[model samples]
Target: MLTLTATPVLDVEPAIHGEGPTWDAARRELVWVDIDAGQVRRATVSPAGVVAEVGIHPGGGTVGFVVPSSDGGWLLGADGGFTHLSADGAATVLLALEGEGPAAGTRMNDGAVDPAGRVLGGTMALDETPGAGSLYRVDLDGSVHVVLRDLTISNGIEWTADGRTVYLADSGAAEIRAHDYDIATGEFGGSRVFLDLSSDDGPPDGLTMDDEDHVWVALWGAGQVRRYSPAGELVAVVRVGAANTSSCAFAGPGLDHLVISTSTQGLDEAARAAQPDAGRLFVVRPGVTGRPAGVYRGPVDALHRAE
Candidate 1:
């Protein structure tokens, strides 16, 4: 059992949609994105302040998620394609999602790094078109693999500790699905329903797994983050008070604090006023630590590694 507590805002700077909070353990900082505003922000955990910020959209698209790269840069899943954001603030196009711009107005959204460090990013249609999104994985060998297709608002992705199971949230479907993962062969199968939510509970948004392998999901319109066991049994729920909780990540010295991102996107004036903290970052600790993401590997690690 976990001790659920009230979540408090960690950062005061609200965003149109604050999301994808990734912990850079090497720097002891929290990195996240203001999606609609097209900015990536970072803050030192101990110091509890915004350290450095960069806008990646000027290079041509909005960033959905960012993971630390081996070369001290970041691998960003952007609207146009994937961009490698250099430490000097340069956004280099790594690959394009489409030959031209997204035809269906789709762009990368929530994502997670596989145990091999390859990035698994999901896309969502800007126009909210059903079945317009898909799941793609960028390999170390410089290859892009489309893992799944015909999805709507492809979001939250995670794998079990052993790297043999994958849990993905298809927000449009309002459910999370699990797949059998082959860590050695870089393949996956056996996707089945893990959890489904009703309109009242809110749609599943971002996801993360704790040290115990319990899946923690942020409910976009529910104002809460819930945890479930590997068997998909609800374990705990933490109230965040924000209607649109986008994503969450474990942070702080012990990685025991669960920090969540919120959003004001799509909210009318009345809705925004009702939830003033709608687009800020919040943190709460339920006496659990988090798994650190693996730094992305390069060609040196090969697409196929030893089992």
Candidate 2:
């Protein structure tokens, strides 16, 4: 098994729910979101020391995810719509899902861009109920297509380097599932169980792929991140002092450093005091390089034709 040693990097005031870890290699920074706090946080690291709180999203409309785009900006998933948020804090809605319909409680949750630059994300019901969620694929043309359905707390999505396999984590079910992917056609098939989290270890939240194509998953409530080979073998475990680890990403200039985000939500005063590092950012050198983040291709126009 792989041994892990984590070091606290940044301690934020109080992030109720911290998730969506993304790295911007060009800027040498890491960006993430505080879901309940309605803020996006950024940390810039240099050869000398770490500078924390480089940026923030003050308007705070339940921002769920943020990713660097090919256009030198970010694609943000917020309540009611998906939009582009520039470094200066300007927002533009690309697609809105707030129309009067069954998708009312649905808001974008976890998402990741495919190797071809297409954005694939999933939605979850506000009430966190089962069968009230759906997965969507957003193309460069600003169109959204529902690709899958029946999910709760949709989280942690990544694609294999070859683009032939897609991995998705359903936190509510404590399970990670994989799908056979068709890069050229933008289709997915062969859904099967990829990994299941033990109740004692908490549930799987967000995950990232390493150079070897193995998956490293953040275990919420378990206070640890576990690495698993592509074949689903447990390879390593990195322990954190916080029980509510939210998500993780490989950052640093070389993409060799693993940055993890944790949460302070649902903890009492005693628990919070016990885990002072809760809701803080942690980093460590994991000796593995991460695939560069995929760019958001927006929405595809041919989605309607596919139906």
**In candidate 1, how many Å is residue 202 off?**
0.8
TM values, all candidates: 0.90, 0.91
Candidate 1 clash pair list: none
What is the model-wide C-alpha lDDT for candidate 1? 0.78
Report residue 232 deviation for candidate 1 (angstroms). 1.2
lDDT of 2: 0.78
**Poorly placed runs, candidate 2 (over 4 Å):** 11-14, 47-51, 98-103, 198-200, 299-307
**Best candidate (score: TM-score):** 2
Q: For candidate 1, lDDT tens digit of each residue in 142-218?
A: 68888888889889898899999999998999999999998876687887898988554799999999999999999
What is the C-alpha local distance difference test score of each model? 0.78, 0.78
- Name the 10 consecutive residues with the lowest summed lDDT in model 2: 298-307
